[model samples]
Target: MKSNRVSTRGILVTLCADESRVGMPGRAAPQGKLTGIGVKPIGEVQWQLLYRWLYGVVELLSGEHFMLEMSHLDSLCFEAFLQTFAQTYPHQLHLIQVDTCLST
Candidate 1:
């Protein structure tokens, strides 16, 4: 992954990733206010912990307006998890695709 800045509909997007290393994508929200950046690794064990935290966020935000960038993920299991999560939520969660690289 690389660092790139994009502006869309008055929203500023910052993408950060290391291609050589596999990690989650971080998003900076509009107006540069929200710390949209994803979790940062502290050690090997933290991945699972971070994932659980993300799951909680997904659950909490269920049905609410939100954006998800799945470009960094290529796991069927994770996709399935997201599908289930989406189904379990009550609000209408809108997924906004910001970049073309995630189409795959």
Candidate 2:
């Protein structure tokens, strides 16, 4: 039997997200020995590229269009990443679940 708790808006989407360290400083010269050179990073700003994907984001509802985005991580942490997503699509997100090994 189908439950009566189905969402009236639409089916929930499972978002896939990941972060990678990009624009990081190249390997430093070891023991004061020069090993060629490349573009150096500016200042102490750490950067990580955030990627997210969700199927059928636009086909679900009207006046609620949202798309994928790529930006540097604010604090280089998972929480910050989640916050950014939430802020971007505040009306779309309903629940958040982090992967954890737990017995019910």
Candidate 3:
């Protein structure tokens, strides 16, 4: 049997569960949009912190889309990136399994 694997590049967006919004940034804003706050990756530690913050925001606001921007990454590192992201934001963001076609 051949192992079939799908290749995807770009952000992964997900919706969080309802009834968990409190003190979360962008809670009062529109759906599928990030809050006015900006995320800057100062270093690896700061990057992780930003990721956690983004995950929290996504988790509180259900029906809102959370995007994982992956354009900067190569296909070979996609899976590892996804795994790390998922682990960091476990049970916070719900993964929406769907394939997206991009024309470049």
Candidate 3 CA-lDDT value: 0.33
For candidate 3, what's the RMSD?
17.9
The list of candidate 1 runs beyond 4 A from truth reads 1-72, 75-78, 102-104
Give model 3's TM-score versus the native structure: 0.25
C-alpha lDDT of residue 44 in model 2: 53
What is residue 76's positional error in candidate 1, in angstroms? 1.9
Best by lDDT: 2
Residue 71's C-alpha lDDT in candidate 3?
A: 30
lDDT of 2 by residue, 1-104 (tens): 01122234545533433333334344433334233478564445334434442211232223333333434333344445566556755545444333442312
| Model 2 TM-score, 2 decimals | 0.33
- Order of all candidates by TM-score, from best down to worst? 2, 3, 1
Question: What is the alpha-carbon lDDT for the whole of candidate 1?
Answer: 0.32
lDDT of 3 at 94: 39
Candidate 1 weakest ten by summed lDDT: 1-10
Model 1 clashing residue pairs (backbone): 1-19, 27-36, 63-91
What does candidate 3's lDDT look like per residue over 1-104, in tens digits?
00111112113334332112123233332333343458653433211112111112232323233344333333434455457556654544335442342322
